[model samples]
Target: MKIKIVENEQQLQDAYTVRCEVFVEEQGVPEELEIDDLENEAIHFAGYDDEKPVAASRMRLVDGYGKMERICILKDYRGKSYGKELLLFMEQVAKEKGIDKSKLNAQTQAEAFYQKLGYTTISGEFMDAGIPHITMTKNL
Candidate 1:
């Protein structure tokens, strides 16, 4: 898997296409919520498997932490390590930006996945976009 910062409109669209497939179509999250106003401020990332986008995420430096948001992978790619690679790539970018911490509101179902990546639950379960979630954090 090759992950790259979304640098052009087409790349950004590719990222959004994957996000829409996973978040909006499969997860029942609203389209508006999936692509929020924070997009202009966040640095977006997309992972491709031989020119086809398989994963996507965005990050913003928020209060000294890299705030990871809208992370998702296509159904066919879920079990692969591409998700991990995408996250590690994002963390590397965060580190290069002088951020030492990472934070995300992870869907409860994915909490274990994040935990395996060294993220610790920081808050109790809560609702976001009508779905259950918990805030998780990790050191970069």
Candidate 2:
């Protein structure tokens, strides 16, 4: 899979399409909440397999940490390591920006997946978009 930095309108829309599929339609996240106001401030990413969007995520510098947001892979594309690949690409992007740490509020169901990549749970479970999540962080 190739990772794309969303630098244009079409690419951004592609990212949104992936997010809407996995987070909104499939997981029941409200469309309004999934695509929030922070969209303009973050660096968006879209993972493609021969031009088909499979995964998407974004990262922003928040309080000196690279905050990962909206990470998701399409249902048909899950369990093939594309999520891990997308995350590692985001981490690399953070490193390039001189960030030394990364943070994310991962859905509880995906907590162990992030753990395998070295994120440590830093908060008790909480709800976001009506789904259970826990804050996790990693030192880059």
Candidate 3:
């Protein structure tokens, strides 16, 4: 699998499709919230398997802060470290864009995943879209 920054409409669609499958369909996030206005401004990344998108994520550079969101991987592609690769790439993008810190709201179930990736939990547990979530951050 190869990971690349999405630069065209097609890749963006692939990213959205993956997100819809994982977030909207599986996680029950409202479609309205699953697809956000941030798409246009965020830097998108997709992991592809010979031209087919398998995993995806987005990074936003807002006020010199990198915020990661919409991270998803196809069910068949999970447990393969693609998520970690996507995040490392996002971190690189953040550094390249001069972002000093990166943050994300991780689903409670995935808190350990982000923690293993060097993100520190910084907020109390809260409900988001009817699911538990916690804020996490890491200095770039």
Candidate 4:
């Protein structure tokens, strides 16, 4: 297994492919919401198991803060701690980019996951893409 930040167009596409499969196809997120606003400017990462992508995520600078978004792991890869690894990598990336704080709007089901990473809830549960979500943040 190899986990590293994606630095090329091919890796970026692979990450987006994983997100599309999990978020758009499996989770029923709209294609429009799944693909919007992501571009070359966003920082992307991928986790490969035997050279095949099994998980991925991306972060973008928002108003001088790093916002982790589109975190997805293939269904077969869940419950194996890959998501935690990816989130840790994102935190390191945020620090490298000179940001000391990070934020994400996490799905309600994932609130506990982020909480375990030391993120605090900042808002009441709300709907995003028809699913429950909450704002979370942590200092790097």
Model 3 per-residue lDDT tens digits across residues 1-140: 79889999998888888888999988999999988776788888888978889998898876667999888899998898989988988898888877879999999999999999999999999999999999999998
Output the TM-score of candidate 3.
0.95
Clashing residue pairs found in predicted model 3:
none
Question: Which regions of candidate 4 are displaced past 4 Å?
Answer: none
Clash list (residue pairs), candidate 4 = none
Please report, as a residue range, the 10-residue window in candidate 4 with the lowest summed lDDT: 34-43
- In terms of lDDT, the poorest run of 10 residues in model 3 is 56-65
lDDT of 4 by residue, 24-119 (tens): 899899988888866667888898989899898889988767899988899999999999999998899899989999999999999999999999
| Alpha carbon lDDT of each predicted model | 0.94, 0.94, 0.89, 0.89
Point out where model 2 deviates above 4 Å. none
Each model's backbone clash number: 0, 0, 0, 0
Give all TM-scores, in the order shown. 0.98, 0.98, 0.95, 0.94
State in Å the error of residue 16, model 1.
Answer: 0.6
User: For residues 33-96, what per-residue lDDT tens digits would candidate 1 score against the true structure?
Assistant: 9898899999999999999999999999999999999888899988888878888999999999
- 20-88, model 2: which lDDT tens digit per residue? 998899999999999999999999999998989888999999999999999999988898999899999
Q: How far off is residue 7 in model 3, in Å? A: 0.8
